[model samples]
Target: MPAVSDLTSHIGYLLRMVSNAVSQEFARKVADEGVTVAEWAMLRSLYGGDGIAPSALAGKMGMTKGAISKLAERLLDKGLIERTGNPGDMRGHSLSLSPMGAKKVPVLAGLADENDATFFSVLSGEEQDRLRGLLHMLIDKSGLSTMPVD
Candidate 1:
């Protein structure tokens, strides 16, 4: 072989290292609040509206209908979301945040804010902004539009 690049020299490896650390810590923090990151994302998405159809939610979250249905069932069982039948369609329904979920959303959002702050506390403000810009550039260039729920 002429030359082999070191694993540490790969940007993907470096990104994954940091990403895992950030994601794991955030997952633990959210877990304490009785919700996973994916559930939180779904709740947050519903926060902007009164309700949304399952198909619409699946499209918005870039998830399959089956995945959304599973998540919705879990949230419903947990009493964090409510379902209402559509007026025109007897079989159609929409999901919305329950009063409990609506209340928990702000608290969970605070945790997310704190998590970001603590994780990036090592970087200077300017450095953090630059890093975000670079990441956005990469996302935009790659046309990565799917929401990262895992």
Candidate 2:
């Protein structure tokens, strides 16, 4: 076997560590706002769209439908989202941010911007763009459409 120093380190390991740290920090920052990271993501997705099917949202978020349903239920309980019967498909339902939720998305979006800047402000604009491109490439190559946490 090759020596550790000579062996290539797996990008997945590093990505997981960094992502977890960022996620944890973001969660802490937003906890007082009464939204979990996952919930925030769902809200963000619906911020502008008229409404989306739960199944479609699941696919868009790269999560299982069960997970999406659970999150949707929580948001409903919080009055952060409203669910309605889909006219196009009676068997399915659609979701949109509630009036309060609609109002809060922009505030939450600002928080998200701050969180990103807190972590990435060290990089120059060019470097930040390059890093984003590289990360997208890695995700594309790895066939990863959703965020990953370890």
Query: For every model shown, what is its TM-score relative to the native structure?
Result: 0.94, 0.87
Candidate 1 lDDT tens digits, 36-148? 99999999999968899999999999899999999999899999999999989998999999999999999999998998899898999999999999999999999887788
Maximum-lDDT candidate: 1
- Give a tens-digit lDDT track for model 2, residues 22-141: 778888766778988888899998988889999899889999999999999999999999999977877988999999999988888888789889888999999999999998997889
Which run of 10 residues does model 1 get worst, by summed lDDT?
Answer: 141-150
Model 2 off-target regions past 4 Å?
A: 6-10, 87-89, 148-150
Winning model by TM-score: 1
Could you tell me how far off, in angstroms, the CA of residue 96 lies in candidate 2 after the best superposition? 0.6
- Pairs in steric clash, model 1: none
Question: What TM-score does candidate 1 get on C-alpha atoms?
Answer: 0.94
Count of clashing residue pairs in every prediction = 0, 0
Clashing pairs in 2: none
Candidate 1: where is the Cα deviation over 4 Å? Answer: none
